[model samples]
Target: MTARLDSVEPAVRDPIRIDFEGWSIEARAGETVAATLTAHGIRGLRATRTGADRGVFCGMGVCQDCLVEVDGVPNQRACMTSIDRPLRVRRQRHGQALAAEVTALPPATAESLRTERPDVLVIGAGPGGLSAAIAARRAGAAVVVVDERRYPGGQYFKPLAVDGEDVAPPDAQHREGLALVRRALEAGVEIRTGVMVWGAFAPAEFTASDDRGAVRYLPKAAIVATGAYERGWPVPGWQLPGVMTTGAAQTLWRTARRLPGRRVLIAGNGPLNLQLAAELLAGGAEVAAVVESARPGARHLGALVAMAAAAPSLVRDGIRYHWQRMTRGVPMIDGMVVAAIERTAEGLAVTLKNASENGGHRRFEVDALCIGYGFEPSNELLRALGCRHDFDAEQNRLVTRRDGDGRTSVAGVYALGDCTAMGGARVAAADGAVAGYAAAAELGLPLAPALEREREAAKKQGDRHRRFQRALWTLYRAPPYRIEQASDDTIICRCEEVCFGDARAALAEGVIAAGPLKRATRIGMGPCQGRYCRPLLEALLAQGSDRQPDEHSGFAPRVPVKPIAIRDLASASD
Candidate 1:
């Protein structure tokens, strides 16, 4: 049975009935299919080939496990597909759909696949892109901002479904992001939502597509602020239906205004975990515990002091979060790491190891497990554009190389937000403003004295945030590599159903890099296109074989960054 709180409010009043496996569920208009189903006690949306149930893992389109047959269209992302009308949604049984399953979409005409040219093309509508667009417009440049989501806030200030219910952000961070959106619109930024940028090509070209058709964007200068996705770490039984990333659970609460579960266990290393705990508690969910993998010690003192000095606001925010947890009597256990998750008849049995106590074990039974290790920059689009990459050893990821002003190695291309560096939204916005200012200045838009002052201030703020982030990284370092805890039966790639044993055997057979391993086991070639499994697989390969991540820098991403329907591609040809 699914646990839902009575405190939750639907985004729409007049209900649109959606059929899920023959069960009629009342869904709101602005809510996604996943939100609608999960709210109605339907978490298991699909079954894997191994017959294990899968639910909303990432709550975004990155993890394709939420694919459901929507109105006869198989493999449609339930989270990205909003419920505008009554529809028939069915559980995709082991990737199978009925023979009669078909949805006829109108063919795309030349006019539909319209091409536009702007002075500046911003690839994301989040804080970064919005700030960039606003600055460019201030400098008398025609700016266009594109985002895949139907809304303008991106992930940081993602507003709750505002079509039916008035859901305001409960926190100041997100509130500020909403305010940025307003400023950008008032500054005459052309914000295009529901457009997916699939590829970036030579001479500043971007190929994007939406339901209407494919669109091409050519711009004098471009800013890539595509943002980042949640990083997944391997633990036994992590593939369970109820186990999801903290980002996923946060989306359920923040964007959808729905609780993930009645009893939730949040484990990982970061401020995001603490913030999630507070949100879950406010949403009336029972937070069992917040198990932090990093142990706070004397070693963290220097970094903490440095961080506090660099960003006092961040320090104050941290103290407030601590106070919230303490006042609510929520146990925030540092020096504890998740060892494994065991399936229980009721929900799940989570085994945690005390890092400070010689790996002593304790078990907690909870209905949901939300894990957040850290974030990896979603830098595929930048890499695709031939942007140089530097391996960030501390983070164990390849981030796109950028100057202080967010200019990439490419002359006309710039990068901001988490794609350039994993600084939070504020840093992204600051860097984006600077990028916009510099780009506009280079494009012959004379920077006013006041604009120059603002740009310098933003640059200074971004630098300070960068220092804070470096200190935070040192203080909250990831736990010692623990891939050994993954049992042989543990599944690594949900899309391909490849287990640890399979990956190990493939590695033993001289599959050293992500590309070879993927070709051998068909691991990253699935619907997600390596978004979910590549990081885990890369780590597994490095740990299994004594090779550095740079030795095999993962599989190179192809065009159509997100999966596009064949019909859409064919329609573009027409």
Candidate 2:
């Protein structure tokens, strides 16, 4: 029996009685307490540290924007949580409740920041987002830019300290990004650092939560340039503390000035792996070996051609660096893969397997193993919003619809940078500029001819990059051996302590599907909310049960769908 979408109507039922801040309300069953209160016109669910009013911003779970107390727990994101049964809500000022007690600080941390509504809310402050913000502000729209990182640079341009002073240097493509962000800041863009817009919903509401406390923003239009994360191949001991993805290692080194380990083993097939090896070696870390899964002669031939033709200087520099490494006795091993890893007191004992040989392996002592196949779009926010997505089997990511401009299927909501499609920073910054100009035009702002021409040029670059990306995806697709890496004892969901054996048992006992397995074992319902574990679990189940990965396995759908504070729910009916 297939569920008919057209048969369901939007109606409230099975009311649950609750009290919020002295007000009595009847919340329908299966409705979030926040949704019930909002329906009853109850605003100001929680108070700021300065005793100011606040409410939901991002409707999704990531932002932690709609945090409130339900029953007794404090600091829960209201949007991600549901209001089943009965919930008590209370108003918690910045320094009034447990949050205050936890920090035991003056109100300055909570009260000193100014709050204002902007006409345009940009979810990321990357190159594309910054360019869009600057254009909007220049056209007389009050603009606010929010980013999860401490600094404004997306992946392309990073902030560095020179002579003990913070400075931003423009990489090959980030130079233009730096100029755009500087222009926006100069033009009065209200930039919020370390703020993540986790959820966006109808009626123009969004939620954001940070160390400063939860804040909600209402904007006329919003742009999503949230970018992407590195995709790690599933393998044994991947969850080990010393095993990090290439991007994670890069972030640690570049942002925090911390090395993941003294001796590193770089594995995985991609140009990025080579780039990371170079960076790690340059940063004074010992590179034990560079193991590439691809047969270099066959896979990198086209890339070599592209490198020589498009970026000869980069090619020369890469050759020179590799030569220096060889001169220093560093070895680059091809046609090899990391078979497994064992944690030792020293660090990690990694097993290396020859790709061409059967049952051939060697063990190497290493402090860290950095692995990443490539990049994938961060689509958690988009998926939560009911946006249509298709699985790009090659890249292992959800695909979004886009036109010449960066418009997604949802009008007034746009995606740019690697989040839309994977390319390096140069393409991302260029796409950001195009999205900015298009968004500005839609907002009734005039666009300069030169900017329009620049956008046209960017499209050409994007096309070329897309072709290159496609070739890379086909060449370095996850090998069949990856599916066999899951041992029976390998933990599937770290948050819930669910393991491969547990999931298999559930399947054998007629749990049968992903949804049922999740319900029986609570595998995907942990605090991370399945972001980190869902894909891997889905893949494993698909392989084990002979089912499609996208098929509903049997996870229960819960309201607020995320962790929420008990106090805010209690306040709504007070």
Which of the numbered candidates is closest to the native, going by highest TM-score?
Answer: 1
For each candidate, what TM-score against the reference? 0.92, 0.72
lDDT for each residue of candidate 1 in 1-574, tens digit (9 for 90 to 100): 0101221222345768988878888876777898888777677888778777888888778888888888877888888887778999998777464353223444554345568989999998888888888898999999888888777777777666634444444467556756777787778778877888887776577888876767788889999999888877677787777888898888888777777788999998889898889888887889999999887679789999999999988888888878887888999888887778888888899998875444678899998899887787788788888888877777777878788788899888999998766888879988999999988887899999999999999999888988998898788885654666667777778788888888889888887777778888888877888876787787787774567665137878688777876566546554
Candidate 1's TM-score: 0.92
Report backbone clashes per prediction. Answer: 0, 53
RMSD in Å for all candidates: 4.7, 15.2
Q: How high is the CA lDDT of each candidate model?
A: 0.80, 0.60
Candidate 1 residue pairs that clash: none
lDDT of 2 by residue, 435-516 (tens): 7667777877776777667767867866666555555545454453465556777766644556778877887787766666
